[model samples]
Target: MVTLKQIAEELGISITTVSKALKEYPDVSKKTRKLVRETASMLNYKPNSFAVNLRTRESKTIGLIIPVIVHHFFSSVIKGIIEQAEKKGYLVIILQSNESYELEKKQVDLLLSKRVDGILISLANGTADFKHLNDVIENETPLVMFDKIAKMVKCSKVIIDDRKASYKATQHLIDIGCKRIAHFRGPLLPQNSIDRFLGYKKALLDNGLEYDSSLVYICECGDMSFEEGKLNAQKLLKEHKDVDGIFINTDLVAIGAMTEFMKQGVRIPEDISIVGFSNWFMASVISPSLTTINQPGLEMGINAFKLLYKEIKKKKKNSDFSFKELVLDTDLVIRESTKN
Candidate 1:
């Protein structure tokens, strides 16, 4: 209930001077700024965010759209983004799309309506239509896509080279004398998943190995949980008894597969070799540490924030900006999962 007027009256200064001092405007003396801040803290005088946003045309907040927060990869990315955003005196609002296109669309609309200064999004799994994203672009809202992106949207993006990384992983399996490689792919719609699948197939074909259609399993069960991975691996093994190598879309899935393999009394790297994407923490901790592609999730998160910040600054300058697709290189991390 304590308005700027009350603070001004108590301080014996004009309301405009109090306002400027609270905002730390250089025009106000440092002594006035300190006194106003102390008084505001005592009074618990919180400025109306809507009014501040209206005046500056900036919410000083960034919206982060992620598929899921439970996964280690997304959690790490969020940590990196928040750390960087905090350094710049910005706040982040997180929204989970839950891997649904409809939910993602609704979240995007809500963020736009809230007038977020910028949006950093990793598209949902089944998001094929990008009209919602296009709406954000039309509104001239700075947008940066990371990980799973809308290919049609020409905007700033930060992602690892999934295709090349997958190729290296598969090639490593082949070099280790394992043929009949099976792929456990994620949803087909996300470009990153498609790219990783392509990389797996390319490695097979390039090495004069036949691409077996029977060996490809699509895990489109909404959640990429360890249970799903275990079930899918079991089904794949049932159908293809000769599957000697496995390329999973995620480290979690690979862990699940390893569990099932061990239960089945299968010798790892002896009877079968395994590779996974995203070098999550469990990958290194699990028995027979997983061989995976290090996606640089935290680095991608930092880069995404920087790109969004640049876009916001460009908008403030009233300058036209070109889209940037930043593809960070990936590394094939070798461990006990694969042999030779």
Candidate 2:
């Protein structure tokens, strides 16, 4: 129960120096680190792993890891997280995995080392291994997954049902007279992507449209970008010229596709009606407004933080961790990109 402040005072050093020394920060000399450790052991000081820094008992900090930082949806999510964390007097550390599993793992380790009170993450696109995620839980830190998440990882999560959302989007396309509908989906590893794909397939079956693998295109976007959308659209045009409707994974890609289609004299909602996921800001302002699914990034962020806060509080009180999965609702927005 020995605090870093007490150790610093006893060692006649600044609290910052004591903290840096304990963390072996490069700025802290080897002699200082050894002295701090020895003096701390002599004082029977034990660091609070849950609270992280003994400096102020709790670091009052949380780590947020996302796939893409610059994304409008993700940026909004960060805004929500920061606002909520600030209300509770907590600081947030934002890290972008750039959709790399390796980078995600390192970031997690860094957060742990820094002793953040909790962690909130949207799994990287390439994260197939759950060991890094498990390590946080195993270390008794409160961990919450949002948006892109893993099903096998036993922890709290907040997400909108991508499959159900995709189903509605596809059905809208079908309702609007899109017969030969094609899909541009995310990578196969993530659950949301898999769910969206299945939902697209199911909609086809239910509506009596034959499910064609040839019509489905996989995007390497991690989170589909504009260029990927355009490239895939070109392919979609060449390979499935008869396709009359398209359900895209994200708005940015959908825009990319729409741009490409326009270049070739394809009229929006005339030659091929289209639908997109995540009602991003640009979805509404484009040449022909994009029809999209409203994924509540801000609300998801607030709710995700609330969930993590609950678990963090529970851990601090010596209570056992109880996992909860909260699913938010998604709605389809009608736009000019699709048939009326």
Candidate 3:
């Protein structure tokens, strides 16, 4: 009920000054801004978001599109985004694409219609064509991509070195007495998947190990549920009985594969060793805990939002903005899944 005008009257300041202070405009002194914020808080003065948005033409909101929500990595990323967005008084609109290109396109359209200030996304596996994303770019909507992104998207990006990480995982297995290693790779579409596969292949070539095509199998799905992992594990065991190690695409799938291996009387780290990407919580709990790549989900999310905010500010100022490609680091965690 209390208004900025009342605060201005009480402080004997102009309403324009009060408004500028509340918005943290550079024109206002820091001392004045602090007093205005404190007074507003004391008065419980909740600005009418709709009215303010109508005036500024900015919702003070951002959209985030992810491939899935039930995933531990994605969940962590969401938490990071929410925490970071809150600091700037920005609200987040989260949407899941279910890894479908059509669904992803729909989500983008929905966010655009909502008139959010900016968007952050992790592209779905099924997304190959950039037409829908380009539409957002053409519309001058600030966009930032994280994790699963396309190199051709021409937007700000936050990601780890998937290829290098995968290579280290494979090499670790080989160093620990693993021979005839197999790979459980994601689908060929997503850039990370392709990079991981290439990394695995390169490690094999570097180690003078045979790069056997028969040893590699695709393990991808909407949620990357346990079934796909188990099925691929079964397939790998049945066809490549001599395989002593596996580099799986994700922790969920890797855990599933481990389950199948256990049921089939395979001894983990003794008969076979496995490593996975994205060190989900389940990785540490599973028997013979998974030794995997620790992808920085929180960092990726925070970085994505930071980049989105920068673009949003630039767009608002009608300033020239260049793309930022931020690459974070990954760690190879050694655990019970691998022989020490």
Over 1-340, each residue of candidate 3 has an lDDT whose tens digit, in order, gives: 9988999988889999999999899999999999999999999999888888999999999999999998999999999999999999999999999999999999999999999999999999899998989989998999999999989988999999999999999999989988899998888799998999999999999999999998888854545778889999888888988999999999988998999999999999899999999999989988899999999999988999999999999999999999999999999999999999
Alpha-carbon runs more than 4 Å astray in model 2: 1-52, 221-223
TM-score of each: 0.93, 0.84, 0.87
For all the candidates, what are their Cα RMSDs to the real structure? 2.3, 8.5, 4.7
**Pairs that collide, model 1:** none
Whose TM-score is higher: candidate 1's or candidate 2's?
1
CA shift of 250, model 1, Å:
0.6
lDDT of each: 0.91, 0.92, 0.92
User: What total of clashing residue pairs does each candidate reach?
Assistant: 0, 0, 0
- Candidate 2, residues 1-340: lDDT per residue as tens digits? 7899999999899999998898889889999999999999999988765654574557899999999988989999999999999999899999999999999999999999988899999999999999999999999888999999999999999999988999999999889888899999988798898999999999999999999898989976566789999999899888888999999998999999999999999999889999999999999999899999999999999999999998888878888778999999999999999888
lDDT of 2 at 278: 95
Question: Candidate 1 or 3, higher TM-score?
Answer: 1
Candidate 1 lDDT tens digits, 1-340: 8899999998999999989998899999999899999999999999987787898898999999999999989999999999999999899999999999999999999999999999999999889999999999999999999999977898899988888999999999999988799999997789998999999999999999999888988886866779877898789778988988999999998899899988998878788899999999999998999999898888989999999998899899999888898999899999998886
